[model samples]
Target: MDNFAHLFQGFAIAFTPVNLLTALVGAFMGIVVGAMPGIGSLAGCSLLLPLTFHMDPTAGIIMLAGVYYGNMYGGAFSAILLNIPGDAPAVMTAIDGYAMTKRRKAGKALFAANLASFIGGTIGILILTGLAPTLAALGLKFGPAEMVSLLLLAFTSIGWMMGDDPKYGLISTFLGAMLALIGMDPVNGQIRFTGGNINLYSGLTFIPIVIGMFGFSQVIEMVTNRMSFHFLGGEKLSIKGSLLNREEVKGILPNALRSGVLGCFVGILPGAGATIASFISYMTGKRVSKKGEQFGEGVVEGIACSEAANNAAAAGAFAPLLSLGLPGSGTAAVLLGGLMMWGLQPGPRLFTEQADFCWSLIASMYIGNIICILIAIAVIPFLTKILKVPAGIMAPIIMTLCVVGSYAANNNIFDVYVMIAAGFIGYFLNKNKYPIAPLLLAFVLTGTLEKNFSQAFKINGGSPSIFFTKPISLGLLIFMVLFITVPMVMKKVKASKNTGDQPG
Candidate 1:
């Protein structure tokens, strides 16, 4: 009942005319950002963060949340029309979405994407609203050992689930963890890997690394490959013309809901983000569909599942941040920093002390998602026109944005260098089919993993058994083991069944 009252208060704040207008404006700007190749929610938010300096903190946060969810809707445009994923999470969407477009069902694909995003995002927000307080309370009971084990579980899951080859994922994770270890030692206050470089004192900024890995790297690839934009079957899509048919809606609804739930759960887990959510959703949708054989050939369910999962994952990414002050993804990390910048600290105390702020943010999520849906439907024609722009002209623009985005993060030139380096590394990794998601996951989770592990060790007198001593830790460990083992077992069973079914 108390929670309900708080939510009503939050709705009052979010529903104010000023805040509502900001939400619409944020959604508009977010779509523009997401439509541009290599720019994502984090970059969009960072670029706009300074603009919010003059606003009330609640209003500022509402706008930022609007941008966050709006990007999820806009990301589908490029993926379907140009076969270019505007964000990393949209990669799965492009695989089938573009195919559907090529088959002259571009409108249907786009419609499915938007509809699924709405469903998934709404469910995710509801889950966050209902479960966050409970989760926050649970977080208060966590000692160092539990935290450490949880991070370890995150690492293990990312390594196991992210790539075609687990080894590549593990290696990427190790590299990220090593990079995370560079700056000041957590316990001893000693500098570890600086090697006399002054910039190493504060460690690598998350913005620089993210911009380097996802943003600059994409620009480099476009430049090197001389990639050109190709519209889907030369078709122009309009809002009114893009509604899905009854059959299409019936086919996609189940998968969208299932994937949304799954993605939300995955999003709440440490080190797992939208990329994994989309991938897993795609695979699961394929496995469950009666017409599974038609998945990559432009199936609507594919687009529905992938888009739904990624959007849900975006919503899910907020759970840890709202509940425990631990961000689940790079974008969330940026939001976390923004919170601190605004002199607002996140955690248990946040819910208790700033009930209106927390619930208002949640309330804004509902408003933001609705605004994004409306904006996406209204602007489809304009966004599709972007597909017609020649790559020769677009390439430079994207590169410029990459440079500006990285430099804007800290107003530092070194970040530009980092962006270039990460771009080269990402390009090679992509060429080699090595998953970058694991590296990103590891990079995001490394600090938490290290801090928790160290604290757990200190609390338990360096005893390894401390991890298993707690029921929650033990259960998570067992769950991790099952997560790793079950996939292999299922693969073997399917192979055996296939062999048995073969004609002699």
Candidate 2:
């Protein structure tokens, strides 16, 4: 009842003229950014984060949240129209969405994506509204040792669960940790790994790295690959043609509902992100649907499951960000930085201290969700036109944005160079099949982990046994170990079974 009352208050705040306009603008820009390939929510938020400095914190964050929600809706546009994913989460959408395009059902795919995104985002926000405060209360019980263990578990999950190979993910995770270690030690206050360079003392700026890796890396790929697209039919993209029939609506409802529920829980997990949620939801749909065999064969269900899950996951990620100061996804990590920059400390205390801000943000999500769907549906005709833009033209525009966004972060020329270097590194890393997500996640979390580990050691007179003595910490450690080991063991068993089946 208290939550409901607070939510009503929040709605009042969100409905204020300035906040509402910000939300609308944010949604529009987010759709444009997400419709462009390679510039995901991470880069989009980073690019626009500088603009937030001029506005009220509430309005600024409202805009970013709008962008986050809008991006989830917009990503499906490119995947359906051009067969290229606008972001990582949309990759699953392309598998089925593009197949629909090939069959001259692009408009239907766009409509299904928009509908599923709305359902999933609504479910996620509802769950988040109910769960975040409870989770924050629960988080208050965690001690330093427990925090350390939990952080370790998050790191382990990122390394062990993401991408095709755990080895590559782990390597990426370690690289991020190594980069994070270059600045002064947080506990000791002693300079380390700076190599006497003045710029290194303050640590690397996150926005530049993020913009380079996600934004500039894509530019590099576009220049090198020079990919082209071909649309099947012009009439198929009309808004009238995009409307779903009764049977189609029924088909999407169950899949979207189920995936929305599943994705929300997945998003709450410390390191499980929208990409993972989408993949898991799509796979679940494949296994459960009656027409499972036709999953990748231009099926509406496939698009619904993938789009719904990713959007749900995007909303669910806020639970940890607000309640525990832990980022639930890559974009959430960027938002975590924004929270700090806004002079608001995230975690359990934030609920009690910043109730107005918290509830208003939640309320705005509902508004943003509605705004995104309406805009997505209304702009469907124009969005298909975006697909006609050539990669050669798009690459230069994104590259210019990347350069400007990076430089604008601190007004530093040096950061521009750093962005370029990171872009090259990211491009090579992707070319080598290494996942960049774990790297960025590790970079974000490593400092927090170190702080908790230091606090635990100080409390226990430098004895590591503090981690084992606490039940929660011990359980978390055990879970991390099992999480890493079980996958390897299963893979080995499967390989052995396959080998045994082959004739000697």
Candidate 3:
């Protein structure tokens, strides 16, 4: 009952003239950014993070969250139109969406994507509204030991995300931790790895590194590779209808709802993000649909599965961050960093201490997603036009943005150089199939992980046994061990199977 009242008040806050305008503008920009290949929500939010410095924190976060959700909606555009996903999460969408486009029902495919996005997004936010508060309330019971264990669980779980090789993920995670250790030690107040450089005291800025990696790295790759695109239909990619028919809607709504639930569940997990959720949903949709055989053949059910699941996952990824100070995904790690920059700490205290801000942010999500659906439909012509914009033009623009964003954060020329260095490192790391997500997220969460670890140790008189003594911390540590070890065991078993099958 109290939560509902708070939500209503949050609606009032979100609808305030300035906040509403900000949401609308951010939503529009986010979609445009996301429609650009390789620039996912992280790139968009990181690039724009500095702009939030001058605004109120609540409004700033609201706008960024809007961008976060809008990107998910926008990613489907290129997937359907150009057979190229704007971001990884949309790769599944491309499977059936592009097929539909090839079948000359691009309009229907576009409509289904947008509709699924709206449904999934709405469900996600609603789930957030319901789950966040409960989790926040429960988080009130946590001690420092539990906090440390929880963060450890988050780190270890997310570390296995590197495709096919968990060791690569672990290496990336350690690098992030090492980077996070570069600044002054929080407990000792002594610089650990600054090498006497004055600029290293405050630590490496998260935004510049993120922008350089996700934004500049891609631009560099494109420019170097001189990437080119060839649209099947050229500049005249046209569609027949903009709105979904009743029968199509009926067929997909149930699946959309099911995917929404699945996506939200996946999102609630520490590192299971949109890509995993979308693939899982697509597979599930294929298994049960009467038109299962036609899934990859332009079926609307396929679009519904992918779009709904990913969008819902995007929304679902917020729960842990808002409630427990633990990020839900790689992008959520960036969002968590942004919150820290604004002097806000995510946790149970956040909801109680800043009810207006948190609730309003949640309220704004509904509005933002509604706006995204409209933009997805009404802007199809304009968006498809964006698909024609070549990589040559885009590369320079994104590179420029990365440079400016890097220099703008602290007005330090050194940061720009740092960004360039990070860009090179990131490019090489990515080229070698190392997962950047664990590194980025590890960097973001490492500071808190250390802080909680130190505090928990002190409280226990420097005895690490407290971690195992407490039930919450013990369970969390056990989970972390399982998460890290199970994958290695599975990989070994698979390798042995393959070796046995090989000829001498």
Candidate 4:
């Protein structure tokens, strides 16, 4: 009853004219950012971090949160119309969405995506409201040993989920972990990898690294290739039917709900984001749907599965951040960093210490999604035409934002150089097919992981078995082992079967 009362109070706060206006503006900006290929929510939020310095913490957080989930809805636009994913999470959406576009059912694709995204976002918010506090209660039981085990689990999960070869994932994680160790030691005041540079003492800036990799690198790639986008036969956008007929809606609702649930669970795990959730949900939908074979060729359920799961995962990624002060994805890490910038530490205490702010933020998500859905539907005609913006015209804009965002992050010229260096290196890494997720995710977790590891050792008086002795830690360790090992085992089995079939 008290919780319900607090929730009502949250609604009161969210419904205020000032807050309502902020939500609308944030949603609009997020949609624009998400629809642009290079400026994902990560870069978008990073670039906008400076804006929060001037506003109330609650209002600032509410706006940023709106941008976070709003991107999920907006990303499907580019995926469907251009076959170019606006962000990593939209990659799966393009598989079916673009196919629908090619077949001239672009309106139906947009309709399916909009409905799925809305359902997923709304359900995810409800689930978060009911489950976050419980998860926070569970997180309270974790000590240093458990935390170390949890980090290990995150590493294993990302490594196994990334691609066909887990080696690339492992390599990416190692590289990130190593980069994370460049700053002063967390336990002691001594710096380990600074190489005598004064700037290194503060460590590599997150904003520059991400801007270089996702923002600058992409623009460089497009310019180098002289990329050009053209619709088939120069066909203009057209849709003949209503947005969603009764039959299509009935066919999609169940799968959208199922994918949302699946995505929420995946999101709760540290580092598993929309990309992984959408792929997993799409595969699951393929296995169960009667029109499974038709999935990649304009199937409505494919759009539902991908869009719903990704949107749900976006909301789900907030759980660990809010409840445990742990980020589940790269964008969440940025948001977590933003929280720190405001002189507010993230963790369970936030719920009690800033109940009004927390609850209002939660309530605003409901409002934001409704706003995002309305805009997404109303702008389909214009949205579909965004692909017409030539790469030549877009390149300079992306480059400018990347540089400006990097400079503003630290107000340092050296960081701009670092961004340029990172961009070139990122391009090289991309050519080699290295997965970037593990690196970014690992970097975000490294400091905390190291801190917990050292603390656990001290608490156990150097007894390593302390990790295995704790029930939760032991279970997490076992899970990590299995997760890392199963892929290798499966590969071996497949190789053996292929060899046996070759000549015998």
**Which predicted model would earn the best lDDT?**
2
Candidate 2 vs candidate 4, lDDT winner = 2
Each prediction's number of clashing residue pairs: 0, 0, 0, 1
Clashing pairs in 3: none
RMSD after CA superposition, every candidate: 5.0, 6.6, 8.0, 6.3
Give me the overall lDDT of model 3: 0.77
What would the per-residue lDDT of candidate 4 be over residues 1-504, giving only the tens digit for each residue?
A: 666677778889999998998888888888887876546778778877787778777778878888887788878886786554566677667768877876767778888999999998877787788787675455456788987897777666765555447687788878878988997988887888888998889888765776676667767777676633233334355444527788889867987998998887666666557766776677567656766557766788988988888888888877788878988788899888878878778787887888898788888888999999988888886665544456666577667767776776677887888889878887888788776656766776788788888989999998999899999999989977876687579879999999999985
Candidate 1 — what's its lDDT?
0.76
Summing lDDT over every window of 10 consecutive residues in candidate 1, give the lowest-scoring window: 227-236
The ten-residue window of minimal lDDT in model 2 covers 227-236
Q: Is candidate 2 or candidate 3 better by lDDT?
A: 2
What's the residue-level lDDT of 15 in candidate 1? 96
Report the C-alpha lDDT of model 1 over 195-259, residue by residue, as the tens digit.
Answer: 98888887776555665666556566667766233432265667666778899888888988998
Residues 1-504, candidate 3: write the lDDT tens digits: 677788899999999999998898889888887776556777778888787888898889888888888888888886687544566677668768867765656777888999999999899888888887564344444677877786676566556544347688789978988898888887778888998898999788765676566656656676676633333334444444456789999878988998988887667766557765776677567656777667767889989988999999988878878878877677889889988988899987888998898889889999999888877788876655644566567566667766775676567888888878888888899799886656766776677678878988998899999999999889979977876677579879999999999998
Structure candidate 1, residue pairs in collision: none
**Model 2, span 66-149: residue lDDT tens:** 888788887788667754466667866876897787576777899999999999999999988887756534544567788788
Q: Whole-model lDDT for model 4 versus the true structure?
A: 0.77
**How close is every model to the real structure, measured as TM-score?**
0.74, 0.67, 0.62, 0.69
Q: What's the candidate order when arranged by decreasing TM-score?
A: 1, 4, 2, 3
